[model samples]
Target: MIYFLRNVDDKITQTNFRKALTIGEISGNVLMDLSVMADEVIGPLLCNPENQKGWPKIVQNDMKRHVNELRNLMHQLKGEMSSQIMLPMPEGVENIYHAEARLKESDSEDVDLYLKTNIEGAIIKWAQQIYDLLQEDSYIAFKRTKFPLPISDIEFYTHRLRNLEGIYSQLRDPRVKRMAHYLESTRSVYLACFKSMLTNVVAALLREVCNLVIQQCTNSVDPMSIFQGDADEQLIKLRKAMGVLNHFIDTYEMNRDKVHTFFPPGVMPVRWSFDFDRVFMRFNTFMKRLKMIDNIVEATVEILKLEKVEFSGLRGKILSTECIKVLEEYTLIYQNLGNITYDPADPEDTRFLSDYDKHMAVLEDVDRRLASLFSQGLDECHDLEHFFKFFQIIGDLYHRPIIKNELKPKVAKLLDFMHSNLDAVKEIFDEEMAKLNPKGVERPMVDPYLPPYDMNRLNRAISWYNAIREGSHETEVALIEKEISAIDHLLGRGVEELTWNDDFTEWMAEVYAAINTLQERVLTAQNNVRRGLSNIAAWGDKPLHNRKDNPEKLELLAVNERHPRLVARRNKILQSHAEFLHILKDNYKLFFNIKEDEESDDEEEELEEVDESTMDEDERLARAQKLQAIMEQWEAKRIAREERERERAEIAQAKFERREARRLKREAKEAEKRERQARRDEG
Candidate 1:
């Protein structure tokens, strides 16, 4: 019952013309014949099949059908290879019809072999060409780090790798024989190589891009230099770098089609032998490197934030203290006077004293305090300049958000401190005046014997009693002046020296300079700190400050008209030179070149583009020639002007030399005359 010697009878039975041949029987015959061949030829000829000497009609028919199927399968595989490998598109897809037509022309049984070899070779060649194109495009696109979605493009390439699996399936089919298998094996080898190459290229591109950005951001510390006059050079360097980067990115985009033309397969087979956990661990490490870079940028911004607040707070405190001291001292002079008339015997009167006593006792205390405070503040504020500049660099690297929560309390505390000191000084002055003069006397009737102004001694005593009274309001100069004048009339109109020997004018100069410096420093610190705080606040997942709209600062327009607390400071600096404000203003312009918005002049009319069809060759040539002539003339004029300027400068130098020579001659003549006079006197 066992089937034996099965070649003749089995082949006839498996034939579609006689017995109803099942797919299994046909497959069995192909494999049995495959086992009979020599081992080397078995694999190669089955893969290629051109070496087969003879074939049954059924096998020949089966080979023909397999050939067509392979042609279709290989085409699909080629597409997958192109896309997965990111290979360049070939000029035209190979036509299956032409391949089949060539196959039919040959009557030889090796026709299948011939067709498979040619098709397989063509597909491999096409894949390689596409891969080369992809490499070229990648090299150009290497500079374009931000390619909308390079990962997505890579994923597309991966998808093609997945489709390429179909070609592998066709190669493994028993019916394809050795020749077809050879083509499939070649494709498999190439796919393995391409997958590895692509993975490397993608990793390299990512690492290179990330590293470049990190280096650019990390090394950029001196932002102030950007605003300096030397910015042009740095700007040029940056622009060049950006242009180079842009060029690479443009190349990447332009060549993307060519790279994707091969539609290479996705789903590269992971090596079965490799450890999954180890691969994942390496991946995690790479991810952490990116995150660490971000954290470093954040930490830098925080450092800047701390520096801004610390320096600003210190500077603000010093300024507020100095301003209050000066104001209190200036108010004291008037408050010390009991009344307008100064009487020597009157207990409340201080006006009878000369400049030495009045200024020394009353104003010296205020002046000295302010000067000391100013000196200390100036030194401290100067020291902080370096710190602020250091932090400014950190601010530029990380755009720190301004958080209002941190700044509100600090600004409020500063304002409150200034107001409290001012109130305290005023209250003290009022209290001192109240104690000096007490009101206890009844109203006095006008008497003929008394002097018209209240110079009477008894009247002075009564006035003093009335002047030394307590009141809620501040003791101003007008109130104290009257009391002093009354005392002076009572005693005699003689002046005596006062103990207050204060150089107020000099003290004021110091106070003003200190306040100005302090205010400027505080304001700068506030700006930098606020900028950082706002950046932080904005960066958070949730906001901490009030988001509702508030009224705009309408009163800012009147800031210029507000009281001048630091005018004396500016005046002190400018006192030695006329137009000091102008000089400072000019110098400020030179140091800080603030750009102003200006209206662009549009006087020139736009020239209409000439129509090429309307213009003759002669006319175009003439226009071009004229333009060249004009450019030449303009260049010549520029050169001539430069020469003339040089000549004029030489002439001016010669004139200056002549004037100096004349002055020297006149000086010599004067010396000779003096010598003659001395000789005459001696004779």
Candidate 2:
């Protein structure tokens, strides 16, 4: 039963292959030696060598096949392969057991040393490899991706660790007891390190989520500025980041369990640097803030859903009050943003106002759009200033005031001016109509030339006037416009309506009036005849016609042609006609002929009478304006005449001077000569 190694077999552990036989020969010799020991372990107490179940067929009925079978099974015991499927490692286990049983003491010592060294070395090396693989990017943590299944990194790595634990089961043999104990202790240490490493990775991921939140709320690179990302996008990113942070906090216990229990073998839990409670509470503030703002934003969205709306109480313009109130609530939340803190000790303490301010800016933009819908007047029924012009048109149409309060005074003032100007012109027109005053006609002798007024201001006033009044004053306005039209028509006749002339057409107006009433005697005679005809019984009878009205009273009417009263009336009519013809002849001359001699005297005496200052303030100003214009013309002509005379006189005297002028020149020359002489002497 004892197996001994010879000199050449010792060459198997030699430095040079020259001392050893060929590889096949050496393998056969080693297998023969190993089979003898296998036979000893299998004798009487164990199975027959030929019937050993796991032995290779060559080893059945031949003791050499036992070692060959064990060695053959070792082919699958390569490091990773051993980990891949660790069940039924019979070759390795039996080899360890058989080595201690039947070999010589020195040879057995050699086998013990070889198995212990190789098996222990392999176990430690594989454990290190597993740890090293976990350090690699892909294997260190289970990859999170949007793939077939949402496999969590913790579960994935935990499953892999459980599979790796299978390798430990195969090492529990007496021959490798020391190796097993060493591996067990090493595995425990590695699992502890792995747990620590895993916890660090999760913590890193938690920190990454926190960084995302910081980027959302505050500036990452800067300490002061808040992030300015888009409002809708910011809201989305914040929600997702908050979810990730919460997930880490929620599964903290489960992750530690995975590291410790059979779930992931001998992994141990490690605490993070900062307290979990503090971290949770700190980030929860952001959630609280988000919840508060969420309500405001939702309300605002509902209110802004309307394409058009109207309300008041906004300063300087009109807009929707309900929507503004919602926006104000949002603003109030932002203004009083509390529980936000920064840590100088922690560079990651970047939860600032940029994200919230950015969303607030988005809200401000909405406000600006809404503001564009406001209008100052009824005519401003559009909000093209805002980008959403078409959307705001309906709001503009409903919200604009009929006339803004500030603009009222300007319109009223200018309208009053126009009204006054019209009245002044009307008064002058009426004065011109009174063409037949017995003393003298009060004809308006206004100057033809006048100063200009501010046409731009007037035109603006007119436009504003029309914009304020919504077409309902037409009846009253039209009645008043007749006077304006009359004045305008007269002015179109070239200011002549305001000027007087010596021509008799205006004076002839009185003659024409007289001609209209020249038959005054006809009314008197008709009245006298009616009285005489009243006494029907005092008249002689005349032929009566039944159809005639009051036939019995017809005698007075029929005899009126031949009666004494009728004869007197006829004679009086002839006398009145002759007198009327004589008067017409005289008036005709006065009407057509100019009284040239009295024109200057008459105009001078009636100058004050012609002034229509008593009519109104506007008329007084008009008259004064006329006088000022005449005075300017007179002053201009006087200055021009004086300039002409001076020019002519200067031409005549250009080469000549009088005695006084010649003496003054001589004295001026003498004074200059004396002054120069005095200065030269002093020098």
List where candidate 1 sits over 4 angstroms from the true fold. 1-257, 260-288, 301-310, 313-398, 401-683
Candidate 2: residue pairs that collide: 50-61, 59-65, 226-354, 227-354
Residue 407 error for model 1, in Å? 6.0
Quote each prediction's TM-score.
Answer: 0.17, 0.21
Would you list the C-alpha lDDT of every candidate in the order shown? 0.41, 0.44
Model 2 — TM-score against the truth?
0.21
Please provide, for model 1 over 258-337, each residue's C-alpha lDDT reduced to its tens digit, 9 standing for 90 to 100: 55444547844332232223323333332333333223223222332322322233675656555554555444443343
| Tens-place lDDT digits, model 2, residues 155-205 | 554454554444334433444454343333334333434334334433444
Find the candidate with the highest lDDT and give its number.
2
* Model 1 CA lDDT for position 300: 25
Error of 2 at 293 (Å): 13
